[model samples]
Target: MVPITRTVPAPSSVRTARAPRRVTRPAIPGVVLAVIGLGAMAVVSLWWRDTPVIHGFGAMLTGAGQVLGLLSGYGFVVLVALMARLPPLERGIGADRLARWHAMGGRYVISLVTGHVLAITWGYAVTAHESVTSEAVTLLTSYPDVLMATVAWFLLLGIAAFSARAARRRLAYETWYYAHLYTYLAIALAFSHQFADGASFAGNLAARVAWSSLYALIGGLIAWYRLVTPLLMFARHRFTVAGVRPEAPGIVSVYITGRDLDALGAEPGQFFRWRFLARSLAWQSHPYSLSAMPRPDMMRITVKARGDHSGSLSSLRPGTRVIAEGPYGAFTPALSGRRVLLVAGGVGITPIRAMFAALPRRMSEGITLIYRASNPRDIVFRQELDAIAADRGAVVHYVVGSRARLGYDPLSALYLRAMVPGLHRYEAYVCGPAGMTRAVVAALRASGLRRRRIHHETFDF
Candidate 1:
């Protein structure tokens, strides 16, 4: 494709001035942390109230187990809340950050559950003058809800094992995702056991009421954001595929036409978790960034053939029904500086391309885009980017070559400083493969940009 380099006047919308939206980064995270801390305190208070005396080793072990179990139950609630896809948390803390927190928290919670089981079993064994194995068997067979809790524990362990980094590599995305859905079932099975057997909850009406309320709140959030909102969007907008246009060898842009799209409140750099109502495609939803600015009746998303779901999008028929979960993410130009820099790698250019067109150019020093691709053929949206650059009086640099061919990294700190004079004054946005994103972020920091000035989101879960 021939590159369009001739300068043309920018559209009136592009030329118009709009003040950037200010977001206080620490405010939401601080509130979330404070709430979690409050929950922890409440869990400990239950144990304090119930445990008035502990005179023996067995009693001490059992008391510790009780506290651990209560905290673990509370942790599960927090874990679900993090992944509930609430708009405030998603936009404030970011989806990638929330996923990282959930993964880390899962590990800790699993460890707590294991500790709770061991301590409780050992304590019971000592108190009854019985073998540990005998005590465990009795607990499972005779206790009111111990059997179900044991099953839940095993299910949780299985999920954690599959979620490990090594196991994730061997598993398909769909397989791993579906396996995680069982977590809700496990939590449900464990709930009755917590109430029936937990020392902290036994005869403690206030504790039981508070614990139940926490679970109810998280469940409501998930139902509204993850379920009801999408159904509402489908009913209101009625999104459907309009066409599929191949961009490069393996990338295609899917056009979606919808009614009252502007009411969806989709911004330039946000993405949607789209579930296409087609054979083999309706079961899974994948997040795709908007590849262009949304029109009143249409939007576009560019997909690269990475796996089964993405590979099938190019063959999607026109008029295919779609259910989109969001216009989510906080990667927009809202918090950017007057002098802005966008760096995109391979298929990561989708959101960057949209931001390039929509970012107001008036009262700005300059806007620069650095697109990195393995080869010329790997570059997507070349012609459109060149046209936008020409029209907006922005700079577009296509850094196309393999690392071996180039002999050195073009996005290194020294090179970045040379390419964009006064780089310290610019706010940078980066999206790419994990390695490339990390490298570019390091380069930006080394080039004197502060951490807050560099914004990024990775698709790596």
Candidate 2:
């Protein structure tokens, strides 16, 4: 840990003129996805409307059930596509937002499917003049594919129950991740029923082809990006742990060496889900942001001992085999705006450090880092930060104190406004623990920075 120190005063000669904005690649707007989703729902509703029999209570109930079923199918395919790790969405919308979208979309699927079950069963019972319970059991046992679909319904409900915030917080990341994989199985079973007896597709060849094509495209994306691409990269790169070094107490940096790693195309501030083939470690993979720019043959990821998995990183020996699944994240220079302001709390500094190294700058007056930690001992890479600051003419401000202590305030809006001159003129990059991120984001917004200019990355489930 480095000692608490005041930031270097802004160079008097530093111009007050606002830094010009960096031209960014035009991102495919997120609303494009929203519009498509709405359009698919409308298509289903239109299909229901075109039906010959349009009136009775039982008929209407069945019709509504069919619409809900169609929407759930749309939800299944789109949700899977979002998680397929496509490069376009990964680079444009980013991992954090993508995960959030998937979660919200999952909620919609739950509602749609739940409605489908109730409405379909109720309608059949009314038409047959049987009890709802008997109708449900009859459908499950008698209908082709319905029994499998019933299994899928229960699987989906179980997933939804565990995905609730309270339940998810108690589960291990590995456990939660593996449980989610069952979603693929659930969708497969559900899709089979759609073809066997789906009201919308009955006697409709065009509908069958369109829906099948959608699923086939999604399958190809998953097979290529999730399975085949990773295997090819593994064979080509042959990544292996070169060494692990402690940067601070309970924090270690792992150096990975591989063949032709330059071809990986990983940028600073990006992360990879690393699966190390070692004792007690081969069971799961974890995301760690790159702590340094990747070289042709090697790369580095810094980890803090936050849990059993992360704490055990220091125990990994050199020469361990590694499989990495990303280069994922949008927290890079591609999102840069005007001037750069890097805000790092605890180990969140990992990505900030890498970005600092790669930031092309003749003068760093416009670049500043606000490194926050509870105390000096919690700070990592203090020496390297100073070296980079000295070489790049940037300033590093270590805000060290416990937030719970009285008269121990740092990282306040006032403090930030003073530390980074022309506060509203910079494009701020913030990475930290959840609490700190929320606080810093609020502070940045209070100080007049636009939401668009403050880019951050998070994987907090």
Candidate 3:
């Protein structure tokens, strides 16, 4: 395994919560139980194939597992569709959680699909022992939709295997994206088969109603997350490119404006996934933090053109229609009760800047911003910070060292009293590269700050 080093600074008060060593034992017992259940059902079904009561009981239990598997499958689809349409989910929520669900859900899908195939195959083998495969194949072929479902299952398995991080890293985003698109096809196939070929749904009215109602709920979530939310966003915030300007080397700021002030109700420190509709940059949809707070009619998305997608954003023209799907995440500093201590590194200062601008006047809450970057050039909105500092008594400490190809930064003892003196009193909000955020949070925690008093945002994904 490749060793992954966490770049967080050592905390003064490290909380020791070690993970349990033996967690896999439960899986063994669960698998054993499942096997026993399957075996008992198979034996009973074979012995009483013609009897309605026995067959129905056996079918009901197996059907429950299959239905559960479909729900998991639907969950996987909904997550994908929603993530694509929302901004805060893709970044602040972290890709790790989504990836975990994808993995576990895939396993459930496999178990369900396997149970479905095995149970049906066993029933066929017992009743039509001589030509099981041939008869099943003939039956499927007779029903075109069933054949489509079989093809869909093959596709689902192939896609599931390809979804491994190793394989995904090798594939282009578009290719990976399209491959997963086959999920909708797979779900359609599976659902159709459940209603058509299965006796569980056909003969039993209650089962059919229950199953259909469950499917409707899943479908509703998918529609809300994907279609309805996006449409509402577009209708309310008709975001058009207000201005596009380069902040630093390759970093472009795209200002956008919506219909009305109240209509585009996004708080400061929130971000959006921006997709510029320019023909050349159509495929480029990325998450960018709002550099400035929402005015009566405008918002800003500042992008550091680093990757293959981001680098092309510099050439985008003004007045470009950018589809923004967001106002997601709970990273805002308002969550914590203590005074705000904003920590920013490099371009990560964008959100911090917005928060400062949007802060209400005559505010009793104390605010301190620690701006850390290699040099002064990397500080995106220095002028704005000066204005904010002058307007409010908010203390702004600018730490510019090791930037501009400079060697080393002297450890400045700024904000030492603010943190250590108060110890457990202040709320620390951090946003930057993963390493920077981790290090800052660690250092703050080390200085006797409570974990609940710390809020951080890392745009690693």
What lDDT does the true structure give each of the candidates?
0.85, 0.80, 0.61
Off by over 4 Å in 1: 1-26
Clashes of each: 0, 0, 2
The residue-by-residue lDDT of candidate 3 on 357-379, one tens digit each, is 65554432576778888866677
TM-score of each: 0.94, 0.91, 0.69
Residue-pair clashes, model 3? 2
Off by over 4 Å in 2: 1-23, 29-32, 335-338, 406-409
Give the residue spans of candidate 3 off by over 4 A. Answer: 1-147, 170-172, 197-200, 213-225, 228-237, 360-365, 374-376, 399-423, 438-448
Q: How do these models rank on TM-score, best leading?
A: 1, 2, 3
In order, what is each prediction's RMSD in angstroms? Answer: 3.4, 5.6, 11.5
TM-score of 3: 0.69
- TM-score of structure candidate 1: 0.94
Q: Single out the weakest 10-residue window by summed lDDT for candidate 2.
A: 8-17
Q: Model 3: clashing residue pairs? A: 12-446, 374-403
Error of 2 at 177 (Å): 1.2
lDDT of 3 at 452: 63
lDDT tens digits, residue span 1-461, model 2:
32212221221112211212243756554664866668687757656665668568777788888888888888898889888999877767778888888999999988999999899999888888999999999998899999998899999999998888999999987788899999999999898899897877888888889899989999999999887877788888998888777778888888888898767777778888888989899878788998876666677888998887899988888789998888888787653543689999889999888877666564364878899888787788777778777766888899888878637457778889989878998888899988888888888999999998888875585
